[model samples]
Target: MAELHEQLQQLWSTANKSFRNVAAYGKRNGVKLSPSTVKGWLGGVVPDSTTALTALVEYLETAAERESGWQRLPGGEWAALYRAAHEAKVKARQKTSAPATTPQRASSAPTLQNSTSPAQPGDIEKARRILKAFPLDASWFTSFEHQASFHRIHDSVQDPLYDGQNVLARNYKVRFLDPDLQRQSEKFHDTVNAFLHSLDHMDADGKSGYSQIPTEWRRSFRDQYESLLRKLSGQRDELMTEYGALINLFNERGIPLLPNGS
Candidate 1:
């Protein structure tokens, strides 16, 4: 059995729950995690599988709610936290099981591979692209509009794309079971999600803030919008480059998935 990850241990500690408590919950669900599994998690071993993660998170959340007057974590937040932690675990496994394939960068580099390299760094790109055969024009859904209609592109365009980003990220993580590309998909998903969330707080017509603004605030709004737009474009382009590279790899291997990514 592996040690419990330190953060997992701390979360459990803060909940005042015992390791035995988690095992009990798993036992009820017929999963039956052991005492050493808790140790393993603390000792930096990730959960054996999603099943174990779900069980641990369930126990943690249940205990946390009970300790905090029984207020359950919001379902969405709960899932997000679990997913983020699970991904971190996936990242850790990738590190130990493999090796650093690219020179580590300063603040902004990928935890796995650098995205901005003129070419994909290593064999990971080959594996990353093989999971999906992108449609030539299929990126329409993922593409950001340079010229904004601004009426409700937030609703019609950005939001849907944000949702799609999440779906694609999950498919990479769970379906293809590729953590590296899963991280890239997650980067795109998070940037889109952040952009979407920002839309709710803005005083303008849409995300671009150019809809019908007062002249005084219009300059600042436009500045903010441009900044946001540049990021959106960059993130979108990176993913597209990846998709294009993936397609190239597929062609090289003579095992192209259908253009529709089927």
Candidate 2:
């Protein structure tokens, strides 16, 4: 039992780190996990009796190759250890017996019916456009292991920026491309249109014909438009990068569709 406890302790430490890393990796893959909840797993303070030990074992097994010296644990022995631990903690077991013999009766099993509506012809195109515009690869997102680390980092730093809320927002932005980007782009266009309309209404002398505009106004407009252009350019670049990665992932996995409109 002492040996078991020692092994459990080591396993706990390994699992704590491994689970977080897995969680972080999943986040990078667009999944999000709560930092506080992840911390509980790492701290060995998980409250669920049925899951605590199982979670530790499962995480350790998943991360065994990544963790040093984890390969030394015997598989059968590990299973035995968990079983023994569970038996020691849970005392009562309810026995279930087969039904007694009785006269045969015909019965029918209920069938489930689908209620979902069929997709429209344009749905696929819309989905493709959305995917192309919003890619998932971003530094803010963490994998499973990184998720655990994120929790630790958050706890130590107490930075609200790394909290799950931001992670979730980033996720939603990445996963649903059209609404977020299109909305922003539409707002930008509206602002630019309004500015141009204002310029159109300027007094004849103030509106100096395009070729006769004062040098100062030209420079100011250039600077303002340049800044807006840069912002849009940066957003486009990020979208491309994410889309490219997503395309590669799908291609490698034998997906038939391309991420881009092509």
TM-score for each candidate, following the candidate numbering: 0.37, 0.24
Model 1 reaches what TM-score against the true structure? 0.37
Residue lDDT tens for model 1, 1-262: 1123444655676678764566566667877454445544454444546676667767776777677655544555544555666677577446534533556668784555233323333433444443432344344445443433332233334433434443443344332223444445445444544544334322233235231213444466778665555554555555556555555543454444465544
Candidate 1 residue 151 C-alpha distance from true site, Å: 12
Candidate 1 achieves a global lDDT of 0.48
Error of 1 at 215 (Å): 10
* lDDT by residue for model 2 (1-262), tens: 4334456566656654533454444445543333333433333222234343444455565665476556646556755655664454233111111222344546664232122322233434443443333323323222211432111122222222123222222222222122332233334323322322222111122122221122454466777544544443344344334445544444443333542334
Model 1: residues with Cα > 4 Å off, grouped in runs: 1-97, 100-134, 139-164, 171-217
